[model samples]
Target: MLKIEGLNVYSDNKKILENINLEFEYGKLYLIFGASGSGKTTLAKAILNDESLKKEGKIFLDNIDITNEKTENTSNIYFILFRILLK
Candidate 1:
Protein backbone atom coordinates (compact mmCIF):
# COMPACT_ATOMS: atom_id res chain seq x y z
CA MET A 1 0.00 0.00 0.00
CA LEU A 2 1.08 3.55 -0.72
CA LYS A 3 0.09 6.32 1.62
CA ILE A 4 0.69 10.02 1.91
CA GLU A 5 0.29 12.02 5.08
CA GLY A 6 0.24 15.74 5.67
CA LEU A 7 1.12 16.52 2.10
CA ASN A 8 1.73 20.19 1.37
CA VAL A 9 3.08 22.04 -1.63
CA TYR A 10 4.06 25.67 -1.93
CA SER A 11 5.20 27.69 -4.90
CA ASP A 12 6.20 31.36 -4.77
CA ASN A 13 4.73 31.58 -1.29
CA LYS A 14 1.37 30.31 -2.54
CA LYS A 15 -0.03 27.00 -1.46
CA ILE A 16 -0.91 24.48 -4.11
CA LEU A 17 -1.88 21.32 -2.32
CA GLU A 18 -2.37 21.58 1.39
CA ASN A 19 -2.86 18.91 3.96
CA ILE A 20 -3.39 16.16 1.41
CA ASN A 21 -3.84 12.66 2.77
CA LEU A 22 -4.17 9.80 0.31
CA GLU A 23 -3.72 6.05 0.26
CA PHE A 24 -3.34 3.64 -2.64
CA GLU A 25 -3.70 -0.10 -2.28
CA TYR A 26 -1.32 -2.55 -3.89
CA GLY A 27 -2.08 -4.46 -7.13
CA LYS A 28 -4.50 -1.89 -8.48
CA LEU A 29 -4.43 0.62 -11.29
CA TYR A 30 -4.83 4.25 -10.27
CA LEU A 31 -5.40 7.40 -12.21
CA ILE A 32 -5.23 11.12 -11.41
CA PHE A 33 -7.46 13.44 -13.35
CA GLY A 34 -8.16 17.12 -12.83
CA ALA A 35 -8.82 20.37 -14.58
CA SER A 36 -6.08 22.69 -15.76
CA GLY A 37 -3.71 23.83 -13.00
CA SER A 38 -5.54 21.73 -10.45
CA GLY A 39 -2.28 20.56 -8.93
CA LYS A 40 -2.41 17.10 -10.47
CA THR A 41 1.06 17.40 -11.97
CA THR A 42 2.32 19.02 -8.84
CA LEU A 43 1.11 16.12 -6.78
CA ALA A 44 2.74 13.63 -9.13
CA LYS A 45 5.99 15.57 -9.03
CA ALA A 46 5.89 15.57 -5.26
CA ILE A 47 5.39 11.82 -5.24
CA LEU A 48 8.38 11.43 -7.55
CA ASN A 49 10.37 13.71 -5.24
CA ASP A 50 11.06 16.46 -7.67
CA GLU A 51 13.28 19.09 -6.04
CA SER A 52 11.89 22.03 -7.90
CA LEU A 53 8.97 22.50 -5.53
CA LYS A 54 9.00 22.83 -1.78
CA LYS A 55 6.98 20.06 -0.22
CA GLU A 56 6.27 18.62 3.21
CA GLY A 57 4.79 15.16 3.63
CA LYS A 58 5.37 11.54 4.49
CA ILE A 59 5.30 9.10 1.60
CA PHE A 60 4.97 5.43 2.42
CA LEU A 61 5.45 2.66 -0.12
CA ASP A 62 4.11 -0.67 1.12
CA ASN A 63 4.37 0.53 4.71
CA ILE A 64 7.99 1.58 4.19
CA ASP A 65 8.67 5.22 4.96
CA ILE A 66 9.93 6.90 1.78
CA THR A 67 9.37 10.53 2.71
CA ASN A 68 12.98 11.58 2.33
CA GLU A 69 13.82 8.98 -0.27
CA LYS A 70 14.82 9.96 -3.77
CA THR A 71 13.30 8.79 -7.00
CA GLU A 72 16.22 6.46 -7.69
CA ASN A 73 15.37 4.33 -4.68
CA THR A 74 13.30 1.58 -6.23
CA SER A 75 12.17 -1.57 -4.47
CA ASN A 76 9.54 -3.39 -6.51
CA ILE A 77 7.01 -0.51 -6.53
CA TYR A 78 6.42 1.00 -9.94
CA PHE A 79 4.10 3.57 -11.51
CA ILE A 80 2.76 3.46 -15.05
CA LEU A 81 1.28 6.75 -16.24
CA PHE A 82 -0.57 6.83 -19.53
CA ARG A 83 -1.33 10.18 -21.13
CA ILE A 84 -3.55 9.90 -24.15
CA LEU A 85 -3.72 12.67 -26.69
CA LEU A 86 -6.98 13.59 -28.35
CA LYS A 87 -6.24 14.79 -31.82
Candidate 2:
Protein backbone atom coordinates (compact mmCIF):
# COMPACT_ATOMS: atom_id res chain seq x y z
CA MET A 1 0.00 0.00 0.00
CA LEU A 2 1.08 3.57 -0.66
CA LYS A 3 0.17 5.95 2.09
CA ILE A 4 0.64 9.67 2.55
CA GLU A 5 0.27 11.07 6.02
CA GLY A 6 -0.10 14.64 7.21
CA LEU A 7 0.92 16.02 3.87
CA ASN A 8 1.17 19.78 3.45
CA VAL A 9 2.59 21.60 0.49
CA TYR A 10 3.61 25.20 -0.07
CA SER A 11 4.80 27.10 -3.09
CA ASP A 12 5.77 30.73 -3.54
CA ASN A 13 4.67 31.31 0.02
CA LYS A 14 1.21 30.03 -0.82
CA LYS A 15 -0.39 26.87 0.45
CA ILE A 16 -1.08 24.13 -2.05
CA LEU A 17 -1.97 20.91 -0.32
CA GLU A 18 -2.88 21.17 3.31
CA ASN A 19 -2.85 18.34 5.78
CA ILE A 20 -3.79 15.83 3.14
CA ASN A 21 -3.77 12.11 3.70
CA LEU A 22 -4.31 9.42 1.13
CA GLU A 23 -3.88 5.70 0.64
CA PHE A 24 -3.49 3.77 -2.54
CA GLU A 25 -3.63 0.01 -2.73
CA TYR A 26 -1.52 -2.14 -4.95
CA GLY A 27 -3.02 -3.67 -8.12
CA LYS A 28 -5.76 -1.06 -8.10
CA LEU A 29 -6.16 1.91 -10.41
CA TYR A 30 -6.56 5.36 -8.89
CA LEU A 31 -7.38 8.79 -10.17
CA ILE A 32 -6.46 12.27 -8.98
CA PHE A 33 -8.92 14.68 -10.51
CA GLY A 34 -9.49 18.38 -10.00
CA ALA A 35 -9.99 21.64 -11.81
CA SER A 36 -7.14 23.61 -13.26
CA GLY A 37 -4.48 24.82 -10.78
CA SER A 38 -5.98 22.72 -8.04
CA GLY A 39 -2.74 20.95 -7.15
CA LYS A 40 -3.47 17.68 -8.89
CA THR A 41 -0.12 17.53 -10.65
CA THR A 42 1.52 19.11 -7.65
CA LEU A 43 0.45 16.21 -5.50
CA ALA A 44 1.85 13.73 -7.99
CA LYS A 45 5.08 15.66 -8.19
CA ALA A 46 5.36 15.74 -4.45
CA ILE A 47 5.00 11.97 -4.28
CA LEU A 48 7.92 11.63 -6.64
CA ASN A 49 9.72 14.40 -4.76
CA ASP A 50 9.77 16.80 -7.63
CA GLU A 51 12.11 19.78 -7.45
CA SER A 52 9.50 22.49 -7.76
CA LEU A 53 7.74 22.79 -4.45
CA LYS A 54 8.10 22.24 -0.72
CA LYS A 55 6.25 19.62 1.24
CA GLU A 56 6.10 18.40 4.81
CA GLY A 57 4.85 14.94 5.46
CA LYS A 58 5.72 11.28 5.38
CA ILE A 59 5.17 9.07 2.40
CA PHE A 60 5.12 5.32 2.87
CA LEU A 61 5.62 2.55 0.43
CA ASP A 62 4.19 -0.52 2.08
CA ASN A 63 4.81 1.19 5.44
CA ILE A 64 8.33 2.34 4.61
CA ASP A 65 9.12 6.03 4.79
CA ILE A 66 10.13 7.54 1.46
CA THR A 67 9.91 11.25 2.19
CA ASN A 68 12.55 13.63 0.94
CA GLU A 69 14.87 10.68 0.53
CA LYS A 70 16.46 9.36 -2.58
CA THR A 71 14.86 6.19 -3.78
CA GLU A 72 16.83 3.61 -5.72
CA ASN A 73 14.13 2.61 -8.19
CA THR A 74 10.64 3.82 -7.39
CA SER A 75 8.98 2.97 -10.65
CA ASN A 76 6.14 1.11 -9.08
CA ILE A 77 3.97 4.20 -8.51
CA TYR A 78 3.63 5.93 -11.82
CA PHE A 79 1.60 8.89 -13.08
CA ILE A 80 0.44 9.98 -16.52
CA LEU A 81 -1.00 13.37 -17.50
CA PHE A 82 -3.07 14.05 -20.60
CA ARG A 83 -3.70 17.36 -22.27
CA ILE A 84 -6.12 18.46 -24.94
CA LEU A 85 -5.66 21.37 -27.29
CA LEU A 86 -8.63 23.55 -28.01
CA LYS A 87 -8.78 25.75 -31.01
Candidate 3:
Protein backbone atom coordinates (compact mmCIF):
# COMPACT_ATOMS: atom_id res chain seq x y z
CA MET A 1 0.00 0.00 0.00
CA LEU A 2 1.04 3.58 -0.56
CA LYS A 3 0.02 6.65 1.38
CA ILE A 4 0.78 10.29 0.75
CA GLU A 5 -0.23 12.81 3.38
CA GLY A 6 0.00 16.55 3.42
CA LEU A 7 2.06 16.51 0.28
CA ASN A 8 3.42 19.86 -0.80
CA VAL A 9 5.72 20.67 -3.68
CA TYR A 10 7.46 23.94 -4.45
CA SER A 11 10.00 25.27 -6.89
CA ASP A 12 11.76 28.60 -6.82
CA ASN A 13 9.31 29.98 -4.26
CA LYS A 14 6.28 28.91 -6.30
CA LYS A 15 3.96 26.37 -4.80
CA ILE A 16 3.09 23.55 -7.13
CA LEU A 17 1.09 21.32 -4.79
CA GLU A 18 -0.73 21.81 -1.55
CA ASN A 19 -2.27 19.48 1.02
CA ILE A 20 -2.22 16.45 -1.25
CA ASN A 21 -3.39 13.27 0.37
CA LEU A 22 -3.86 9.91 -1.31
CA GLU A 23 -3.79 6.19 -0.72
CA PHE A 24 -2.96 3.36 -3.08
CA GLU A 25 -3.78 -0.18 -2.15
CA TYR A 26 -3.01 -3.45 -3.77
CA GLY A 27 -5.32 -4.36 -6.65
CA LYS A 28 -6.43 -0.74 -6.79
CA LEU A 29 -5.39 1.75 -9.43
CA TYR A 30 -5.61 5.51 -9.86
CA LEU A 31 -4.84 8.17 -12.37
CA ILE A 32 -3.95 11.87 -12.18
CA PHE A 33 -5.56 14.03 -14.81
CA GLY A 34 -5.03 17.72 -15.30
CA ALA A 35 -4.44 20.36 -17.90
CA SER A 36 -1.03 21.86 -18.62
CA GLY A 37 0.71 23.61 -15.68
CA SER A 38 -1.61 21.83 -13.27
CA GLY A 39 1.31 20.36 -11.29
CA LYS A 40 0.89 16.84 -12.57
CA THR A 41 4.51 16.60 -13.69
CA THR A 42 5.73 18.21 -10.50
CA LEU A 43 3.91 15.70 -8.35
CA ALA A 44 5.34 12.84 -10.37
CA LYS A 45 8.84 14.17 -9.88
CA ALA A 46 8.27 14.59 -6.17
CA ILE A 47 7.11 11.03 -5.84
CA LEU A 48 10.27 9.84 -7.53
CA ASN A 49 12.53 11.99 -5.34
CA ASP A 50 14.26 13.67 -8.25
CA GLU A 51 17.43 15.42 -7.18
CA SER A 52 16.51 18.60 -9.00
CA LEU A 53 12.98 18.61 -7.65
CA LYS A 54 12.36 19.80 -4.12
CA LYS A 55 9.23 18.91 -2.20
CA GLU A 56 7.85 18.34 1.28
CA GLY A 57 5.63 15.36 1.91
CA LYS A 58 5.18 12.05 3.61
CA ILE A 59 5.41 9.06 1.32
CA PHE A 60 4.64 5.64 2.70
CA LEU A 61 5.38 2.47 0.82
CA ASP A 62 3.98 -0.53 2.59
CA ASN A 63 3.70 1.69 5.62
CA ILE A 64 7.27 2.97 5.50
CA ASP A 65 7.73 6.69 5.27
CA ILE A 66 10.60 7.72 3.02
CA THR A 67 10.60 11.46 3.14
CA ASN A 68 13.41 13.77 2.11
CA GLU A 69 15.70 10.81 1.53
CA LYS A 70 17.59 9.46 -1.40
CA THR A 71 15.30 6.94 -3.02
CA GLU A 72 16.35 3.76 -4.75
CA ASN A 73 16.61 3.11 -8.47
CA THR A 74 12.94 2.21 -8.56
CA SER A 75 12.24 5.86 -8.10
CA ASN A 76 12.86 6.99 -11.63
CA ILE A 77 10.95 10.11 -12.66
CA TYR A 78 11.55 9.81 -16.38
CA PHE A 79 10.19 6.29 -16.54
CA ILE A 80 7.00 7.20 -14.75
CA LEU A 81 6.46 10.33 -16.84
CA PHE A 82 7.04 8.47 -20.08
CA ARG A 83 4.72 5.68 -19.07
CA ILE A 84 1.98 8.13 -18.29
CA LEU A 85 2.49 10.08 -21.49
CA LEU A 86 2.40 6.92 -23.58
CA LYS A 87 -0.86 5.81 -22.10
- TM-score of candidate 2 on Cα atoms, chains taken together: 0.77
lDDT (Cα, tens digit) per residue for candidate 3, span 1-87: 667899988888788899899886655457889999998988877877767766776977667776665756437533563455455
> Cα lDDT of model 1 overall?
0.74
Query: Which segments of model 2 are wrong by more than 4 Å?
Result: 71-87
Candidate 1 lDDT, tens digit per residue, 1-87?
A: 778999999877789999999987655557789899999988877777777778888888768887767766532234332211111
As for lDDT, the candidate ahead, 2 or 3, is 2
RMSD of each: 5.4, 6.9, 4.4
User: In angstroms, how far off is 85's CA in candidate 2?
Assistant: 29
Report residue 36 deviation for candidate 2 (angstroms).
0.7
Compared with the true structure, what per-residue lDDT tens digits does model 2 show for residues 1-78?
778999998888688999989987766667889899998988877887875678898888778787775423343434
Clashing pairs in 1: none
Judged by whole-model lDDT over C-alpha atoms, candidate 3 comes out at: 0.72
lDDT of 2 at 86: 13
RMSD value for candidate 3: 4.4
